[model samples]
Target: MERTGTEPVTARSALGLRLVLAAVYTPLFVLGAVVFSLWAASAGPGSVPSGDGLAVVAGVCAALAVLAAVDLVVVVRRRRRERGGRG
Candidate 1:
């Protein structure tokens, strides 16, 4: 297979890796945020005291989710542009 670099690379093909990564991370981050947020909110029992550190974990998760979402949007926009305004 001789390489010539003119095989019509598509947006989906070009950005598949990053798209998959962003999609995966978005849910994971949201899940982490929800779980830690719940834990932080339910900090009114034994062992885990109130205002310990669950909130911080939740915050970080939320922040990561936001960042990942932003990345996802950027990737999607780039893909659309690559696709000649199909979005």
Candidate 2:
């Protein structure tokens, strides 16, 4: 019954891991997006160099945040279904 490395991951364990990862990353991405966005905005009013790079980074972060959020939602729904709504 020992699992080989090549064995496919079980749905439950995979989903559980995904749930944890999504939960952790969602917040981090959101925070990064916010911070970067603020920096990008501030550059416009300050003497700092062009905010173009910062703005691009912020956009990427925002996209990642949205992706993570979607992953989190999907994982939650799957876990809920796996629990048969009793949990």
Estimate every model's Cα lDDT from 0 to 1: 0.84, 0.82
Q: Model 1 over residues 2-83: C-alpha lDDT tens digits?
A: 4468665451254778889999999999999999989888787554555458888899999999999998998999888877
Q: Tens digits of per-residue lDDT for model 2 on 20-85?
A: 888999899889989988888888655465588888888898899899999999888877877788
C-alpha positional error of residue 78 in candidate 1 after TM-score superposition, expressed in Å = 0.1
- In the predicted model 1, the residue pairs found to clash are none
- Candidate 2, run of 10 with poorest lDDT: 4-13
**Reference-based lDDT, residue 28, model 1:** 100
Write down the RMSD of all candidates, one decimal each: 5.5, 4.8
The positional error of residue 22 in candidate 2, measured at the CA in angstroms, is: 0.7
Top candidate (lDDT): 1
RMSD of 2: 4.8
* lDDT agreement of model 2 with the native: 0.82
